[model samples]
Target: MNSRRATIADVAREAGVSPSTASVVFSGKTPVSDATRARVLDAAAALGYTGPDPLAASLRRGRSGIVGVLQRGPLGIAFTDPVQRTTMDGLADAVASVDASLLLLRPVPGGPAGDSGTAPGPATGAATLATVPLDAAVLIGTIPEAAADVAALRARGVPVVVIEGDAGEGVPRIGLDNHDAERCLAEHVRRLGHTDVAIVTLRSELNVTHDRLGGARDVFPDAPAFATLASSIDEGLRVGRQVFAAGRPTAVLAQSDLLAAGVIRAAEEAGLSVPGDVSVAGFDGVPVDGLAPYELTTMVQPAVEKGRAAGAAVVAMLLGEQPASVTFTSVFRAGNTTGPVPESRGVSPR
Candidate 1:
C-alpha cells in the first residue's frame, strides 16, 4: 500500500485550481472567492489534508514559532508552584498572539554551564539552546545556569529575556520589586513588636531569595537565616522543623507561600500556636492549599504579569523592536497568619 501525505499542490489539482490559488484558500493571506474556497475545502476534505504542515510553514518564514524557557528545576515543580505555573500561563497567553509555543529547556548537570540538555554528557551542538531552532529564549529564574547559552544566543543574534533575574545589561528583564517587597513584609513584622525573627529562604543564589532576605535583614539585621533548595512546602517544613527546634523566634519570615505553609505546619506540629506563640509570614502571596483560617501575611508578586512581559519582550525583540525593561511592584497583604510577637517568645527585656 502506497500511503503518502497529501500536499497543497495535490489539493489544488483535485480542486481544478492552480497551486497558488489553492494555497491562498488555505492561508487566507489573500482573498479567494467563496466558490473557489468551497472547492478547495471540499478537495482538502477528500484528500485528508488538514492544512499545510505548521513546521514547514514556519521554516519557510525563517522562524520556528518556539520559545525556549529554561526550566528552573524539575518540570513537575513548574506545574506545582503557583508563581511558576501562573507565569507560564501568562507566557502562553502572550505567545499565542504570535503563534508561538514554549519549550522547557532543562539544565544538564555536569554539563558545561549554559548547556540546556536532559542529562550530563555530549550534547549535540544543535541540541544546545544557542543552536536550537527557537525564535527566542527566556530564562526562568536567573541567568547563571545558562549564562554561556545566553552568550551564544547573543552571538547568534537570538533575542533573550530574563524573568525575575539579571543577565547583565541589554537583556530585556521582567522584574519585580523583590527588595522593596521583602522590606515591606519585614517591616510589618517589626511593627508587630517582633524583634527576634528567623528567615526561611528559597535557594540562596536566586534573585528572589537575595532580595527578600536583604529586605528582611534591612529590618532585622541580626535575624538568623535558613535556606532551602526550592520554594516548596516540604522544604519549608524541613527547615521550619530545624528553625523551631533551635528556639522559637517571635516571628518567622518565609520566602514563598509554599515554604511559609510548611513552616506553619512545623510550628503546629511542634505545639506552637501561630501568631499566639509564634508569628509566621511568607512571600509570593500564592494560595496555600488546605492552609485554612490562616491567610498569610505576604507579598503578592505579579507572577502572571511577569511571564506575559517576558513573552511580549521576546515578540518585540524578534520583530527588531526594542522594548524597555519592565519592573513590577509587589503589594503587601496583611493576612491572618501574623500578629504581634508574644512577650514570652520575644527577646529578654533590658
Candidate 2:
C-alpha cells in the first residue's frame, strides 16, 4: 500500500472504535474507558499518528486560547517598574483561570516610553495584531497608539480591555482615582505648612500622570513641575537634581515611589536633609529597593487589583459578557519622608 498521512478515522478503524471515540481519546474533552484509550493510543502509534493538530483544533473551536498583552516598551525595561510587575502578577493569575496563555506584544520603534498612552506604528516582531491569532487583548497603559490598536483588534473581532488609560468608546477600563488620591497627598503636605513645592511626574502623555499632576497643582498652583520619560529611579534622580538646581523647595511630590526615593538621594547628595530640610512625598506605595533608613510618604494604590480587574474583563469579554469599567481608590500612607515645613524658612504656614 502506498504510504499516506494518517487521520483520526484511520486510527479509529484500526482500533475497532468510532472516530468520535478516537477523537475523545486525544482531546480529553470527554472521558474514555481505559481499554478504549489504550487501544486508541496503540493504534495511533502503529499508524505513526500524533495527536490532532492544534491549529486545526483551534479552527474548529474558533478560539486560539491566547491573550495578547499590549505593552508600551521593551518587555525587559517595562517589567522593572514595581507597579507593572505587581499588576502583571494579578493579570496572570486571572488569565490562568481561563486556561489561556499571555503573549507580550510590543509596539514598533518610535513609540512613546513604556508608560505613556501613545501608540506605535507597527510591532517589531513577526507577529503583528493583524496577523497573530488572539482570542483577546489587554492594553496595559494609556498610549497614544491605544485608539489605533483597539480599532485593529476590534476589526479582527478580538475584545480589548484597558488598564489606567483611555481607549475610547465601548472599551472597558480598569482605572484608579488618580486625581483624588494625588489631591489627598497634596492636602497632607499643605496641612504640614508646605507652600513651596516641586513636582516630579511620569510622562505627561499618560492620563494617570496628567491627573496626578493636576491634583497636586490644584493645591499648589505655583509649584514647578518636571516630567520624566520613564518611571525609573535613574530618571527620578536626574529630575530631582534639576528641581533643586535653581533653588530648593520645602517639599517635593514625586509621582512614583521609585522617583520619590531618587529625589531623596538627590537631596542627600546636595547636603540637604530629608523632611528636615525638604519634605518629600510620592504615589504608588511600592517599595524602593535602595531607599533605606527612610520610608516614603505616599498614596498606596491597589496595583494588583487593577491588573486583576483587567484580566477578569478579558475573560468576561471572551465569554461574550460585557463587563463594566472599574475604578479603584488609593489610601494615604504617612511615612518618614514628609513632615511639617521648617519653621525657620522665614515663611509662615498657610
Candidate 3:
C-alpha cells in the first residue's frame, strides 16, 4: 500500500497546471475556464485527493477552532459531579456559537493539572498549553491551584478563563459568592439555636470548599471540618458516619447537597431524627438523586450561568478583548433538614 498521502502538487502534475492553479481551483478563490476546472477536478478524482488537509487549512486560517476545557482532578471523578457536567454542557453550547469545538482536557492520573497523555510525546507541566492546539482554555473548579497553569497557557498565547476559581490577574474569572452563600446557610442553622456544628469540605483543593468552610466557620468558629474525596452520596455517607462516630454535633454542614443527604442517612442510622435530634445543611442547592420529601437547606448557585460567562469570556479574549472578571451570587434556601436545637437529646454546645 502507498504510505504517502496525495498532495495538491500531485493533482497539479496530472492536470498539467501549477500547484497554485490546482489550489485555486479547489479553493474557488480565482475564476478558471470551464475546461481548466474540469481538468483539475478530473485529476483530483484520479489521484483520490478529497480536499486540502484540515490541519493545513486551520494553519492557514491561524486557528484550530478548538476551545480547551481543563477539568479539576481526574476525568472519571470530575464527570461524576453534576455541577461540573452541567458547566461543561453550557460551555459546549457557547463555543458552538463561534463554530469552535470544545476539547476536554484532564489531568494525567497523577501527573498534574493539564497533563494530558494525548500528545506528540511525554506530557510535561505545560504540555496542555504548549502541545494542544487551543485558541482558548477554560479552567473549571481549579481555583487556588491554577495560577501557574494559567501563566503557562498565557505565555503560549492561549486565552484563559476560569470558572469557580482564580488564576491570577488579567485572567477573566467566573466565580460564585461561595463564602457569603455558605455563611447564609450556616446562619440559618445558627438561628435555629444550633451552635455545635461539623463541616464537611470537599477533598483536595477547591476554592468553593475553602471559601464555603470559611463561611461556615464565620458562624461557628470552633466547628471541626471533614474532607470527602468526591461529591457523591457514598463518600458523604462514609464521612458522615465518621463525623457521627467522632461526636454527634447538633448540626452537620456539608459542602454539597449530596453530602448533606448522606449525612442525613448517617443521622438516621444513629437513631437521630433530622431537625428533631440533629440538623443538617448543604450547599449547591442541586437536587440529590434519591433525596426527597425533605427540601434541602442550601445555597442555590447559578452554576450553568457561571459556565456561560466563562465561555463568553473566552470568546471575548479570543477576539482581543479583555473582559473583566465576573462574580455571581447565590440565594439561600431553608428546608426540613434543620430546626431548633433538639430538646430531647439536649444537644450540648461544643
Residue clash pairs of candidate 1: none
Top-lDDT structure, candidate number:
2
Tell me the tens digit of each residue's lDDT in model 2 across 1-350: 86888899999999999999999999898999999999999999999999887788789878887888887766865478899899988998998877778888866554443322224443644455656789989887766756667877887789999998888889999999999999999999998899889999998767888899889999998888998888888888899999899688999999999889888988988999998999999999998887888999999999999989999999899889999999999999999999888898636555
TM-score of 2: 0.83
Model 1 lDDT tens row, 53-121: 987998798898889887767878778888999999999999888888998876666665534442344
Candidate with the larger lDDT of 1 and 2:
2
Cα lDDT computed for each candidate against the true fold: 0.85, 0.86, 0.82
Cα lDDT for residue 97, candidate 3: 72
Over 140-192, each residue of candidate 3 has an lDDT whose tens digit, in order, gives 76744466567668778889888877777787889899998888888888877
2 versus 3: better TM-score goes to? 2
Ranking by lDDT: 2, 1, 3
Best by TM-score: 1
Q: Count the backbone clashes (under 3 Å) in each candidate.
A: 0, 8, 0
